[model samples]
Target: MNALETNGLSKEYTGNWGKRTKVSALNGLTIQVEHGQIYGFLGPNGAGKSTTIKLLLGLIAPTAGTGSLFGISIHDKRARERVGFLPEDPSFCAYLRADEFLDLCGKVLHMDREQRKKRIAETLQMVGLPDKATTRISQFSRGMLQRIGLAQALMNKPDLVVLDEPLNGLDPYGRKELKALLQVQKSQGKTVFFSSHILSDVQEMCDQVGILNRGQLVECGKLKEMLPVRNVRLKVSTMDMDTVNRLEPLVASMTREHHHWIIQLEGASRTDEVCAILRGHAQQSIEITRTTETLEEFFFRRIEENNLERGITRPEPIMAMAEA
Candidate 1:
């Protein structure tokens, strides 16, 4: 059975001023996360990413639809008892130590004294915060705090782990270590559901991904299935403005730096024709460079395509896993 499943889930909030604004934080969102899979949920601001997480966690009542964890209704306390969550911005009792905070979370999960102790120790070690267990929450660095947040989430060793921007405020090293921990968790047969705004992290960590925009999930599936076809980059050592102008419109875009021109083609479809065109007017020798599309390229391409389809403009593309 899937670890987490949602069918037409949605949430709407009512304002304090009695203004009738029906903001659908989640609009008929439907998704399913399988066991041991790291499902990456991608979206722009106000795209209902957190709302879905909150609904699945039973932190708030869903305005519409239903979801389940481990075949149990999300509204059931037993279902929540089997899952763990870490918010993007985690805050605990500032005066309490890391160990104490984790203890509190363990108690909330109804763990016995002996069970909580062993689980807390293991989780702290798993997240690389074992040595700093006694350190107060206020004294921890941003990276340290993030790690503790993860540790607390794993205190009960729940079957489904949902992390909202798990790498938020983490340093380069911390991010690496946390990613390694996530892999270990998956290897142990646990499901990981994480949302991120960094495409690279999602690409590297998630087995499957879903892209959301304007409260709608536009794409979903394995990364390999969604990867675009090969594309080539051309570097021509030419100073003639006429040759550059001639090749610019034939391809996607071109950049000129000093006497060298960098030309980018969308795919391998007509690259041979482009090279032949460049060769006809080359004032100097040119070099050909080839590279496949990375996860970021795939993400940007999807976002651009969605914008064109809906005729709605968006600002610069949001970076995955990087946004708070």
Candidate 2:
């Protein structure tokens, strides 16, 4: 059985007007995650990622459909006991020390004296906060708070760990440590469902990905399948428009400058065909080049498509996306 499953899951929020107005946060979304797999839930703002996570964790009720964890309904006590969650913003009592917070979590999980002590030690070390165990949460940085949150989530040693925006507000070193910790979880056979707007992180860590747009899942598949195939790109700088017109069919797309044509050819078949087509117009000089699309490119294209479909104006890239 899948570690987690959502069937026709949906959440609709009614406006104050009571005129039967509805906004579907999740619209008939269905997904399954196997044990020991790292699944990336990716999307831009307002894509229903948080809604899906909330529904799965039973923090909010689904308008239509059901979700199960470990073959049991999420609302069941058994299922809730086996799952862990860390929201995007993890806030707690600032007066409590990191260790104290984790102790509370263990106690809530019903761990006994020896069990709680041992688990807290191991979890603190795992999150690289063993030294900060006694430090007040108020003194901790945003990144440190996130680590403490992760440690608390792992206090019960859950089978499934769901983290929303795990890398948010983290520095390079902190992000690296978090990624390493996630790898350790994977090695331990724990299933991880992580949400992020950072495509590069998702590309690196996720085996499977699902992209949501405007409360609807626009794409879902294995990482390799979802990524654009690596292929050659040619920059055909020519002064002739007639030659560029002939080359359009052989290439995926082309951009025309005042006196040059930039053609992008994908895959070997198309590359060879494009070369041949360019050779036929020998009068026009053809510059054959090769380049592969990055995961960021694929992500942006998908986002642009979604934006265009909704007639939303595209804005400049977010700082994270641009840097990635």
Candidate 3:
């Protein structure tokens, strides 16, 4: 069964009561997250990431269309029972200890005292916060608070985990630990759907990614398939300056490191041409590597393409506008 599915899900808000200005927070967002996969929801600020999350959680009703969790309507209370969520900015009672907060979460899920105790212990350890159980939440560091917030989300042992900006405020160590935890969740057949601005994290961890722009899904697919091959990087050593000068025009770009030159060719088709040139220069120590566009590069390219297609251009400067 699909972990989550949305069809034409949309949300709109009225800006002013009298003016009746409508702002579309989400528009016809259709995507599916399969069970046991880590799906990354990506977008710039105010691109409807939060709005879609709220709609799926039934915290806010959509202005159009619908969604479901584990084949159950998102509007159904039972759907929430199978899901766990961590918001972008989570708040907890300052005076409550880590364990106390998790216990309260368990109670809300109707877990018994014994079950809550067991799950709380396991969750704290899972999030690498076992030692912070008795520490007051007010004293926790930002990373610690994020970990504890994740701990509560996992406390319910839900099948679907929805996290918004899950890596926010995490140090390198904390981020690494959380990535490992997410991998563990995937191994146990849990589906994770998370929204994050951290492109590198999404690139490394997500099985599939959906990109949202101006409240619309511009691209959605598996990471490997969505990223197009862009260039081939050839690292060559012991090539003479004469050869470098001769071959510079045929390649897209070249940069000199301490002892070797890194050459970027437009495509793999140029590999043989580059090799022939290297051989002609009597260079034997050459390494040819194919490099694809990174997630960040692909993201920007997609957004730019979308803008061009829609004729969305930057406004003219004040002076230019006045002259026009």
Candidate 4:
């Protein structure tokens, strides 16, 4: 079953003065996440990533369309019960200690006292804050607070976890630790849906990715399929200036390094043709490797294409709020 699904989910905000000015925070965003998968929501700043999360959390109502969590309507309070959420900026009772905060969350979830105690201990350790269980939240560092927020989200042991900009306040070590925790959740058959600006982490951790631009989903699919081999690189030994000039049209680019020439073919299909052309040149050996566009590259390319399509010289930020 799909963990999350949206159909033309859109949100709009109107100016305080009048209805004449309107902003579309999210525009007809339709996407899905399957069970037990790590889905990454990627976009630049103010791209409606957080807006979508808020809508899913039922913090705001959508102006158009609908969404669901594990088949339950997002509008239904019960739907949120099965979902754990960590907002981009989370605020808690600063006076409460870490363990107290988690215990309070457990009580809110109606977990039994014994169960809450056991889960709290496990969660604190899982988030690398076992030693800080007695420390007040106000005394915690930004990274530590983020970890505590994550722990509370998992305290309920919900089937689906939604995190907004989860790596924002984390150090390198903390980031790596969180990534491993996410992987562990996946292993245990829990679905993970997160938004992040860190493309490298998304590229490494997500099985599926959706790229949002100007409140629209420009790309969504398996990470592997979304990033395809854009070109092929061939290393040849018998390549000289004459060979380079002759093969210039067939290849995207070429350069000589030390004893061999590095040629970039436009596509994989041209590999055989280029190899045949190089056969008569008496090359000792040839090494051909396909190069795929990275997630960062694909993201910018999509944004650029979208801008060009809309005749927009400079893209404006998408609205990130919904009208009451």
Candidate 5:
């Protein structure tokens, strides 16, 4: 069975007392995530990414539709028994020490004293805060606070981890460490589902991704399959000007790199013809590399295309996470 599933999940909020403006936060969103994969939920501002997450975690009831975690209905408390979550913005007991706070989290999961002790130690170390266990939560830096939030989430050794904007407020090194930690979690057969504005990190970490826009899922599939090979390149030893001239028509762009010639082609279909000219006819030794459309590029183009088809004239503010 899939680790997570949502079918036609929707959420709408009624207007405030004075106004009759109902807002559709999420609309007919459907997705399935398999076990042990890092699924990146992506979207532009006000796209309902957080709303969908809240629905999936049972923090709020969906206005319509159903969802399940490991075959258990999301509405059932048992569904959350082995699930861990880190909210986009989390507040904690500022006076409690890091260890103390994690101990409380473990207690909520019904772990015994010894169990809590073991996990508090383990998770602190897992999040690179082993030395700060005795430090007060009020004293930690922003990055440190995020680390502790993650530590609390993992205290239960959950089977599935759901994170909203997990990469928010981390420095370069912190982001690197957290990405590595998430990969380690997947290596342990735990499923990871996270939303982030860091497209590069999501591209690196997620095997599966779902792009949400305007409260609906615009795209969802295996990352590799979703990004097609868009460009082909060949680097080779110096070629005769005549041979290069013969190849000029088929190549999109040609340049010299150090002592070699580097040529880029528009599509994978040109690989054979380009190679045939370089290797078979020209007899030049060549190196071939295919590049795909990057997640960032795809994201912008896809969202823009979606907007255009719907007659939205303005470009979207893709990186503004606060409104999403």
Candidate 6:
């Protein structure tokens, strides 16, 4: 069974007044996350990413459709016990000590006193807060607070970890540690699903990804298939000007620096044709490399195309499409 599944999941908020009265935050969203895979959820601002997380965690009821965790309904209490969540901005009791807050969280998860003790120590060490065991949360720095929040989320040893903007407050070293921790989680056969604005980090770790635009999923697929090698760069040294002229029409761009010549071909197919022309050339050496589209490039391109299709010149407020 899939670790997480959603079918036509939609949410439309209804309120008393203002443009926020009736807002369609999400629409007909369907997705499945498998076990032991790191799934990255990406989207532009106001793209229904927050609303989807709220639905999956049962923080709010969906206007239509359903979701399940490990084959159990999202509304079921048991299903939530198997999942851990870290919100974009989490705040806890400032008066409580680091261990105290985690102990309370573990209690809420129904962990025994002895279990909470051992787990709290382990989680504290895991998040690099072991030295602050007795320190009050009010004394922690922004990054330190983030670490504590992460510690609480993991106290239960959950099967699936869901995070919203997890990389927001972390420094470079903190981000690196967090990524390593996520990799460790995957090694232990745990599923991790997180939403982030950091595309490079997403590209480095995610096995699969789903991108939302204007309340709908515009793209969803494995990373390999989404960003395939598209262009080829051929570098050759000691090429004659006559050969350069013969190669001009077949390449996208060609330039020379000292004795080194660089040429860009549209695709791999064109490389073969170019190679045929220089088959017997007495060149020093030839090197060819393929380049793939970056996640940032693919993201903006998809969002731009999707926006154009929906007649959105720019990002509009939630009220732009609200109904009351």
Best by lDDT: 4
List the candidate 3 regions with Cα displacement exceeding 4 Å. Answer: 16-19, 232-265, 268-289, 313-324
Q: Kindly list the per-residue Cα lDDT of model 1 for residues 252-301, writing each as its tens digit.
A: 88887787778888877778788777778754666776666787877778
Clashing pairs in 6: none
Better of 1 and 5 by TM-score: 5
Spell out the clash pairs found in candidate 2.
none
Question: Which residue window of length 10 is worst by lDDT in model 5?
Answer: 313-322
TM-score of 1: 0.78
198-222: candidate 6 lDDT, tens digit per residue: 9999999999999999789999978
Name the better of 5 and 6 by TM-score: 5
User: In model 6, where do residues sit more than 4 Å from their true spots?
Assistant: 17-20, 234-263, 268-288, 315-324
The better candidate by lDDT, 1 or 4, is 4
**TM-score-better candidate, 3 vs 6:** 6
Alpha-carbon runs more than 4 Å astray in model 2:
16-21, 232-265, 268-292, 310-324
**TM-score against native, each model:** 0.78, 0.78, 0.81, 0.83, 0.87, 0.83
Residue 257 of candidate 2: its Cα lDDT?
67
Candidate 1 worst ten-residue window by lDDT: 315-324
Global lDDT for candidate 3? 0.90
Q: After superposition, how far is residue 54 of candidate 3 from its true place, in Å?
A: 0.8
Point out where model 4 deviates above 4 Å: 17-20, 233-264, 271-289, 315-324
RMSD of 5: 4.0
